[model samples]
Target: MMRFHISYLACAAAIIGAALTAAPTAAAHQTTHQTRHQTTRLVFPGQSIQRAVDAAQPGDTVLVTPGTYRESVTVSTPGLTLRGTGRETVIEPGTTKAADSCAEHGNGICVLGTKDRDVEGVTVASLTVRNFTGTGVFAMATDGLTVRNVTAVNNGVWGIAQERSVRGLFVKNTARDNGDAGLFLANTIKEEAGAADTQGTVVEHNRLEGNRIGITVRRLRNLTVAENHLTGNCAGVFVVGDENKPRAGALTVRDNTVADNNKSCPATARLEALQGSGIVLTGTEDTLVTGNHVTGNAGTSSLSGGIVLFKSFVGTPGERNRITDNTLEGNAPADLVDTDTGHDNTFTGNACTASRPAGLC
Candidate 1:
């Protein structure tokens, strides 16, 4: 009886082993119906960028060879990476300008995102965009977008702009001679939606020069602008509240070389009135401008200084804005300018050559 029981247990074990061995084969057969992923599409000069974009799928890369292509490309596909061979690959807007490109601004490269369609996880790298009618690279309503190693020169209004986009990264790019801010970020969502605070936009290790403003951040939360060389612009960095919402803050400007921003602005109707300053904080709260080397940003206006803090009627006062640990030297008029309305704004541990509100250093 013991031998019979042992034989029956051995048979049951053999059956279980057979089933386990066949399960993987069955799974592989079922997965055979899935489509194969598309490979990288190599595009030559004079090829249509839009065609390659249309044919690309998620996880596919469209790589353009080194040359000049006169085309305005629109990328609405998610998870697509459009990379050029190098800075020699220039993309110019084509002859027939689309009146409706880039939200009617007519951009060189537009990454579109909306309620129905979401264009997230897109990357534009290693290209030069010049002479576009609108922004060089415009990304709206996107998430996880990256723009790196690109040269945006002489674009219409902005060099690189992100509106209502979250988790964006703009690094190692050069934005020069743009009409407006070299790098811009703002929110398009209404404040009532409670999603106005788009977080984690990083602008680092870039050169912003010869623009209206070096860098501009508005209606954004948790922004980090660090280690950038902002020179020869109207303003080094401009952080302020938007006209409609007027309650934007939580910015960090540190470790930047803000110098020689003595550009002239003659009461322009459109340009930033506060020019020739290293860093300007208007209507902000809970901000930090620290560890920056600010010098030679001199102009005749009071707004031209090492750092200026003021309050606009657009939002709350400039409360709790700390300006500390910065190296301020030889700025015109004063090293620092503080208005009375900037309540609770402190300047401690600063090495300034001179200060407007004297003896604050």
Candidate 2:
């Protein structure tokens, strides 16, 4: 009986030792899996920026050091932040030695955030994005994106293009001398056809200069554009909505200094057609253009005005707009033109340097 009890005790001790040994292996497997799923940070020293972005997981930060990275990048992941150590971190398109006939297709930074998952905390800050074959920063179908303290210049297309159902903040950025509009916001087919609204985009406190147009908006709702310095461009702000789809909505343009926008030289007459006026509102409703200093926007061939309003194609008169308390001067032709297509649009207390007939005012 003593021998049998000792044998039983030894077997039990062996079983306990096996359990103890297996516990650490099970725990290690779990820890390894969790580490794989955790947010990762990638540092780019001499490596390519695209490679770093490709290796980054969701919720990762790609901290780029000061260097000129000549490559176009596309980020499709959600919750990623791509930031530079300073404004000196430059990213541009790779130049090709091929003939100019070859069509180039790439942007400095392109974010295609289209999943049902929210693409939150995608911050791009303190970088210089330039000379891209496409837009400098293209935010398409994204939400909760932020761009700050960046400079976009000399792009083949728009400096910053926000399309589809993009809701985000664009602040303290400079866009200059791009081939297309400095900043453009448009609704894609998905947003326009779907029931969801592109309602929460804010463009503020930026400097736009020497572009075809400073800012252009189409088929957007509940947008605010204020306190921006738009100068030496073709036009300051162009707000037009799709009359066919009938999606024009509320926009507030106030407290901005729009001046000297049509500054393209006569030698660039072909390019001057793209220049913008102080403010051009077409086929839009429920807009307020007030408290702005609009001046010195002389179009290349035609007379430019501080504000030009046109009727909707659906024969609905442009209504419910308030043009008040704006200092309008130095633009060609007149400070404001109603075109007789709009009705019930009031202009009160607006200081206009160009005199008009009593009824026109």
Candidate 3:
């Protein structure tokens, strides 16, 4: 592949400049008539946010006032809005952990839906959840689930996570200092299966730092990650897949600033040691990677690069993906590294300084 020295940064701006949909707040879910008698449940300091949430009806709003509350919250009802007074509302582990399934599972907040029924249209917004042994906010089997403006820090596995869900929107959130990926979206975490279509789930405008990976989109399809800031993680964004029947791909990573993700994380049971990786695609196909700014990420690990098309841990090769119109610089090893050959991957119209095998700048 012959490398071209073209700056499509200006052209990329014109193409990706269309404004996205205005994010809607949880309180705006109901119409005027439906909200005429909207119930408002309040939780004060020293009170339980969970108590208020449990007492609320489907359309009710559980609003927690500013204070530190040490308890895990579980929301099972549909169409409920759980809001806090911004960052002033803090939730951490309680002294004697709640015996509820959520707390027992080590999660800060749980939105539960059974396999037979999905909790629909529930929203969690504007709070801080930290110091949990498990996820900051976790959801399963939901539709139209929105988690916005939540600050998730220092969690064990994931900051904000979801599985077996659809049409979920995660925007304007901050996830930092997590043990694993700051934001994790997957078909299911418990088993190996074909990829699930997310029906256009969106992750946008979030800041991710100090995590194993900023965001991990695993075994899912039809999702979009855009306009996010990622730094201080071992890897910026990982689009991961394996030998599952329907390969994970058909997603978009666009218009994001990913820089200096040079934190060194030892290899996990399933993955290699990682550092300074910008956007990585493994065992996936037909993905569109465009209009991203990846800079100053440098490391010696095999996975390290500005943009990497790697064979999966299970040795599934990526195929037919487009790596285009990105801006990259100062990435050691290479600005673009394609580890698999004859896979029909294309690298075109990017402004970068170096590449591993010579022509993919």
Candidate 4:
């Protein structure tokens, strides 16, 4: 009798523990369903965008209908998706010269301006954010952020600026005619004297045009920039190392169509003589510039080239880079210029022609 009683007690204790573990999981599943499915559609017919973002919760969808929203929007919640109805959904400042004059200095849309990891997994899609005094869409110190099918034009600075440890998808966005670079990515190093590492970013299938620099990557690693059309910018792409950090590594620039950039006018009364190039790689290492069509770069006084590898500082020269399979043509003098003080950078299979090469059609 005593043995049977002890066995029964052991079985009862095991059952109770199992029940305790399963209870919390059931509650969590119910919470997830409540958060994700609870969506709110926001129509902005002369209303403010700030109001709609304030009313959103985690895992909620804010569907913005087709209209003009003349206020800045910031997303501080995690798992929130703000999607526009169509391309006509515009987000700009209320004033006319608000962007250029810096009268209203705010981002059109933002995810986590403050340094908090709580605001992750935010997505902004299918909107036209233009003419903002600051960045068009700024993602700072956030992870798993996605910006898709958005058009950002004529901003004072970068169209999309990702800073300080942001890992995300930026796809099918068009950034054009901005004053600075179209897209700027710098890992969230503080302005103080320290180094912060930004890594594992994918920038693909976008159009960057008419900006001072098409795309600029600073102090980054494990980055892939591919299949984008960079045209009519001062320089098609500029990759530089932060002098403070000096450890920018392993960028892949592949299969991009970089053409008609480096347009130079004569030195005006107010301005000095200007020049640009197709690709400017400065103080970077282990970069692959391959299979790109770079053409039509012109300079006013000097000659522009297809690729300019410039050595910025007096360290180990930018080495171990590969430039291969690119069709380089229509620049002034040569196709490639290596002004680097360092050595051992290889250039192979680059076809240069005075006219358009074959298979560019």
Which candidate wins on TM-score? Answer: 3
lDDT of 2 at 244: 48
Clashing pairs in 3: none
Count the clashes in each prediction.
0, 5, 0, 1
After superposing all C-alphas onto the true structure, candidate 3 shows an RMSD in angstroms of 12.3
Per-residue error (Å), model 2, residue 78: 1.8
Global lDDT of each candidate: 0.78, 0.70, 0.87, 0.69
lDDT of 1 at 115: 69
Q: List the lowest-lDDT window of 10 residues for candidate 3.
A: 1-10
How large is the C-alpha RMSD of every model relative to the true structure?
13.6, 13.6, 12.3, 13.6
Ranking by lDDT: 3, 1, 2, 4
Worst 10 residues of 1 by lDDT: 25-34
Candidate scoring better on TM-score of 1 and 2: 1
Give the per-residue lDDT digits (tens) of candidate 1, residues 1-361.
4453334334333422321222112111110011245445556544677778887878777766667988788888888888886688899878765555553576888988886655789999989998986799988888889999999999978999988888889999999999888998877523432114666788999999998889988766688999999999988998876334435777798999999998875556533465678888877777899999999998876568889886654444677889999998888778888863756788999998788779866
Off by over 4 Å in 2: 1-42, 95-104, 115-118, 189-196, 264-276, 300-303, 312-317, 355-361
Model 2 lDDT tens row, 273-303 = 5443688776677889889999877663432
lDDT of model 4 at position 162: 83
Pairs clashing in candidate 2? Answer: 233-261, 234-275, 234-276, 235-276, 235-277
Tell me how candidate 3 scores on lDDT.
0.87
